[model samples]
Target chain A: MSTSSDVDLDEVYSFALDLAKQAGKMLDDAWRARCDGGPQTGHVEKESAVDLVTQTDEDVEAFIKQEIASKFPIHKFIGEETYSKGSSKEYLIGKEPTWCIDPLDGTVNYIHIFPMFCVSIGFILDGEPAIGVIHAPFLNQTFSACRGKGAWLNGTQRLPLIRNPIPPMPQDAPKGCVFSCEWGKDRRDQPDGNLHRKVESFFNMAAEIGGRQGKGGMVHGVRSLGSATLDLAYCAMGAFDIWWEGGCWEWDVAAGICLLKEAGGLVTTANPPTDPSTARIEDTKLGGRLYLAIRPAGDTEQETGRQGQERTVREVWRRVRHLDYPRPGA
Target chain B: MSTSSDVDLDEVYSFALDLAKQAGKMLDDAWRARCDGGPQTGHVEKESAVDLVTQTDEDVEAFIKQEIASKFPIHKFIGEETYSKGSSKEYLIGKEPTWCIDPLDGTVNYIHIFPMFCVSIGFILDGEPAIGVIHAPFLNQTFSACRGKGAWLNGTQRLPLIRNPIPPMPQDAPKGCVFSCEWGKDRRDQPDGNLHRKVESFFNMAAEIGGRQGKGGMVHGVRSLGSATLDLAYCAMGAFDIWWEGGCWEWDVAAGICLLKEAGGLVTTANPPTDPSTARIEDTKLGGRLYLAIRPAGDTEQETGRQGQERTVREVWRRVRHLDYPRPGA
Candidate 1:
């Protein structure tokens, strides 16, 4: 029960960035300790047999929660590790002025000494994220956003993400564009060749974008950085034009969603919204997964902009068609 | 010529790090300049397309060569940009000390303001990489190696990269594990769908590794960091177990070859050697566009003092089956 006019976005954004940096310091300390011990011995719990969560996860989350309580005692707060335990059902999310956090997103990677992890702090007021901050301590990079004012990396400087039309790709564009994807945990449930087909087509379509359907086109390459939040942040910066991800939760994307939107990047389901009118992109509620299309900033050609991106996606989808699997979580 | 007795391991290692950092600083300056200006404006040249090469690439390479000339006056150096232009084919690698440098490894990612790129500098002596250093400035991480002393990250710290046997992967590790494939400048020569199948199988095998494949082992994952050197660097760090790359030149893998081997990792062509006995890894003369695998350190169940890294690699190879492809040059 909040209106834009009622909330002070500038104040909330400042607070979010502060919280994110504090949480990032906590995560960075744990990461350095874990890397020091070598990749394995850092485990504190089991996200899976191979995957792990360290004490830093809990310590960081607790620190963030404590700060939020002191600053805005009336607000609701949710964290990933705690949510994994219980207490968060509709009753909590249905509440107003809630703050969502992933104290250290990409915990497994952090444990394994990969540097793509980040601390995500998102402020959701009236059931929507109004201010978001993503801080990656190792890189000393911070992406912050306040509703309507746009997003900034580091601070103050707005990022305007724009891209040219896709149908007729720019001639100079690399035919091998890169992408970020995840293997997801539920590997056993997929059809025999379905998963393979999906990834294979991803490559195929990248090769074919401006070229013939099966001939190589404009994409030059694809890469997987293994962190959803970082992936989204890069997309917002226009470093990557498209990011397709599956099997991630809202916390994995909420802060990044705000960042991407503020940077003028577009988010849609990997599967097109059945009813675009009702699509709830805020939480990627249209589907369990998300596909983000980011364009670089400029005076863009609207028709070309729509078709170029749509075509790139369609091309990827066409390639993915070779692998036939049920939508995840179905 | 550098014999084990002649090479100053510490000095070369330090110099490599110094060169990488200096290059990194130059790249940083260019990065800031680019950020201040709008996106790079221009057409893709015959040398490279996209505004991929920033002033950073040129400045860093120039700085590296200048340093090499003043410090290692007698040593020959080969770099990406210069090497891309014609050099006397007769200047073939010999039993002389030479340096292979890729000042900014992930140029495209760098131009896009992506943080995954790095500066890779390697020293080759007697036709084999003697010392190597890869500095990823954005991530604030540097990976290095001295032939016999073994590899280190940030120096001083040894990479005790030994992973306890992955408890006989519950699923028989599939032959279709993650493959780091690239869609380079060759698209029309091969159909996109044809290449897509390789990606499809990669996913399928990974998805079914634990369920459909024997022992229900699922294929682990795939990553394309975009830079061939960084890809190998990750493999060297054991961040990735295998990195299969095709459609690249010797400059792409030269420095990485040293670090990969020094990390107790293994490298072999995707296709079997025509004469396995004649496959002299130390001989830089054999240049081909093909497969490369970097295996991590693994403990042998047997108490032999030697690391049983080979057994693990053989086991991995047994699990993976490459998608058949018609030879590119043939």
Candidate 2:
């Protein structure tokens, strides 16, 4: 809980990392406890039919908030569960030093013990993410970053930011680039939803990636990590070329945003960018729009410029064509 | 290594588990060694535009085969890489013991380090999975089973055999009931590619699970855990229901098939059953049909099944109308 007045940014980052480690330990303990045949006390409700919410989720969120508040009373906080109940009031740009948290990001995976879940904590100062700490306790891995400092894995290893140049579009999607997506909360209601369309776009893009040489997409494959925080962290680590999500709150992405930015990756709209610098993180949400997070594909690759990752992503977005398709040619 | 004359399944089970552990370690070392900073050093090429192959993938498969041959000379082997070169030469049923291995199931996820990858090994005696082992080395989890004996996690904790029954079909697919599938290799090149149709059907089923109550599809959610072996293990553990896959060889599922059956789960073809006894696992692949590994759901709220599990799973499966789409949509 180091504040601007009490400590430098580095000190604050170190403190955040410490808190994340502590939180990570709690999650690990909880996971083990549950695994050891603990009580089936949690409720089974689908946030989206695919997304699960249980008491453990609430418990984890409360634990993170309590620990953070007790240690650093002055820092502002916005957490997922709380935000769902009106804590989102302060997430605006130019806010006080705030820590946005998704205590257990992949709740659905955790409930099933899928092991792709994580604890994410992000620090925002003056409307921009300054430092972020994400821990996948189950995997025993941590990713952290500060604005001026480069991103690091497990504290000692410095990670380089890398993305391949958007190779020529194939007649199909590359079979390798795995796109990560969420099923969201209201898929059944929509049937032919923008999300479904988005999924189709992903398939279409993947098709293009694997399509014949003349008709392909840029990425090789797609994946849905089940957690936004982990998805961003994966993108930051160059494990994925693009991560797009809609209907997510700041807490779900706050920590990942910092890690992604620090990794020299860009998180922008899936739609064409009208303005670049003036674009704020909040802009990531306009139009229920998706955020395209691309790793920094180097100089020769950068020659593709704005049309680079941004263009490839936007092209996929536009190529989606329809959010809802007629049910099986009916 | 165990033949019927003098073979103790337990001993072979123990040996295979040991081998799994050793192989897992090798995989861990390789994974870490490859963690050096760089955009992944491989291109995803789809032969026939449906099958995907990468250099590191071939190397990993080769490394695994070499290690196994060096350690156990008599055990017959079948692997994804090997089968890629030629169709499986079925082992004599009830004859000598043989092994099936997916050196890396979920290779796409492995390439991305999405953490759902695993080294899978299934031992067959008399044409049945006698004992099976699946290890996600990076995740530090190994699921193993010996026929007539319950499955164990990391060799200590016994997994619950009863699963939550497949709930009624959701209007949208739920998130918790993960369905693991792979895009067929040479998808477009294949005949009548109903691949997209299958994907669309999956989307419908999965989306229903995540849809609103009375609206969303069955259970809580859907997931593609990347690795077929692990996905089946999860199903056996009741972590998910209805894990289906197409275009995968016995190597990708042999170990998991045993685990699922032992855990009280059921496996069937998505198509109509013609001959249940001679279901040669591949019959589940009705002209590129899908494999369904379904767990019985119970009336109890706990993971433990009470009454509804079996009937519910059967009913739900029956409800999912078979898609008539061709394998490689024409």
Candidate 3:
């Protein structure tokens, strides 16, 4: 099922950037052999007890499925710790040339050493996500991309990070921006409203607009840096101007949604489909769970070395959404 | 007022680490002049508009109070943009030899580049915080300490970072450690109960025990990292075991409460006053506007190179307290 004119997207994005830097050097030599003053022990737990999984997340997902089965051993795989056992839920149908993994994502912020975990990879073909890589060997940064060649970091080639690579969203852009979200592992509270619409959308996007009682979205900041593929590669390097989430897993955002759609950034759905007359964002049904990235906007203002931003998409889903969160098994 | 035996404390912690690395190189060259492609702009605002401030947070607090009054020319200052103008509040009294600065402790995450900010300093005399420094130039990390000399980082010397550090708090530990906080500039919702006890103590410390209904703190992760001196210097380099805050300012916890009491932790108060009588956590009234830190514990068991951990202080303040927060002018 490999498309993009019979696969050759720079040799599958240089073999998914050398198997995501060989699963980030076997998770940096097994986190310097059991955390030499960093991670701590090989913490092991899963499917409950605050959901964690370590031993360097099943030894970097069995060395990235044994180096992609010794270099494309008839592709097709899905990782998140051996396709997350039990109660059956391994998605992605039909699209054969696969290899979606989340080798170490944020294993509970890598058993609490917490340096914003990573090492993601994506490939898939006819079913979409062409090629992508994300590495964060302790924030060294490496987001990559293919299928029309755009998203790149730690290797930009495009001089001076494109005169202004990814920083748009500014039509009076929610005051000072830099939103991000997460708090997953569903701890449903309130009359059970996804922790009361995530504490009422993080206190109405960080209160103000007449200060408290003002139904806020005064967003200038509200991060939750416990990785969602480095929260969509830091919202595709616009350094987070918004990131909404929900019970993730398409190996935790198919390589940061291909570096947030090759850094032109938008990606939606923190709850949509409110009678949009057959609402269709390509028939929204993503399973890396409800997301809402945003960083690149549009309405015709961003000029200098453009690449994204003018605010539309119905003005950033009417300034940061949450279309009545609290779904799952409703 | 310079007593700690006439304060030489390693020459005021090497002149507060060369004035916090010269205010982190003049805030990394005024954040590469208006964030070329990073933070986006000057974000001109002060006590509102998402409570921000820029022009490199008043040019890194007038270059860290002009290099600490040109190297301590008879010290005494308090700079959080000059005692945060208007509504009078310049704390730290008697025995004056102060210096407490903040300069750019995450100015809304440095106008939203979102790289947890820093550049703290401290050096009170009879008023205590003998000397400290915190750097974090885009997280290169600095953290310093003095009074009786102990804490350090990015200068880890004193033998393999104190012969293998980053290990404190064990007492049957597995409750998934790491916890840090901040949603500052108060957006208090849920009938303003400190944002409903911070979303009910982050959904009862990230719910579990019979799911949701059993309540939580089954914690293993929860980071906010907008920067309170790099969240008490990443909870004094143990990489966040706990950190709590409150409206912040004694130049942001007088340089992380002297690097969390020189990294042997515990800094109390999210509301401490249910006395078994004379509450003496150094006469708890920390005006960096409420803290909580923790890290090192004690109840005996911790031995060998022990630095702080035996647990008891009413068993670590009844396991991470917040005492139904909602205080500031309740």
Q: Of the candidates shown, which would achieve the greatest DockQ relative to the real structure? A: 1
lDDT of 1 by residue, A1-330 (tens): 534455566777888888888788877776555445534434554544434566778888889999988977767778877876773323245437778888888665665444567998887766666777899896788988888888787885556422321123232333535565555544554543435434544554455444444533346557676678888888777777667766566677778888887776666666544443344443244224445454443333543544455555544443443323243334
Tell me how each candidate scores on DockQ against the true complex.
0.35, 0.29, 0.19
The docking category that best describes candidate 1 is: acceptable
TM-score of chain B of each: 0.77, 0.74, 0.34
Ten contiguous residues minimizing lDDT sum, candidate 3 chain A: A304-313
The 10 consecutive residues of candidate 1 chain B with the worst lDDT sum are: B167-176
Model 1 has a DockQ score of 0.35
Task: Tell me the alpha-carbon RMSD of every candidate.
Answer: 5.4, 6.3, 22.8
Q: Write the per-residue lDDT of candidate 3 for residues A177-291, one digit (tens) a residue.
A: 7778877665545463665566566666676554445546667778887888888877676667777777786778887787667766757576644542344444124453677
Comparing 1 and 2 by TM-score, which wins?
Answer: 2
Ranking by DockQ: 1, 2, 3
lDDT of 2 at A217: 52
Best by lDDT: 3
Evaluated at residue A273, the lDDT of candidate 1 is 47
Tens digit of lDDT per residue, candidate 1, span B1-330?
444456676887878888888888777766655566644422244443322555567667888999989987877878877765654333355677788888788777776657778888878777777788888876777888888978777775555343333212112333323334444444432543435434433444454434435423354445567788777777676556556555555556776777877877777665434443344332223245555564455543553212333333344444434434443333
Q: How displaced is residue B90 in candidate 3, in Å?
A: 18
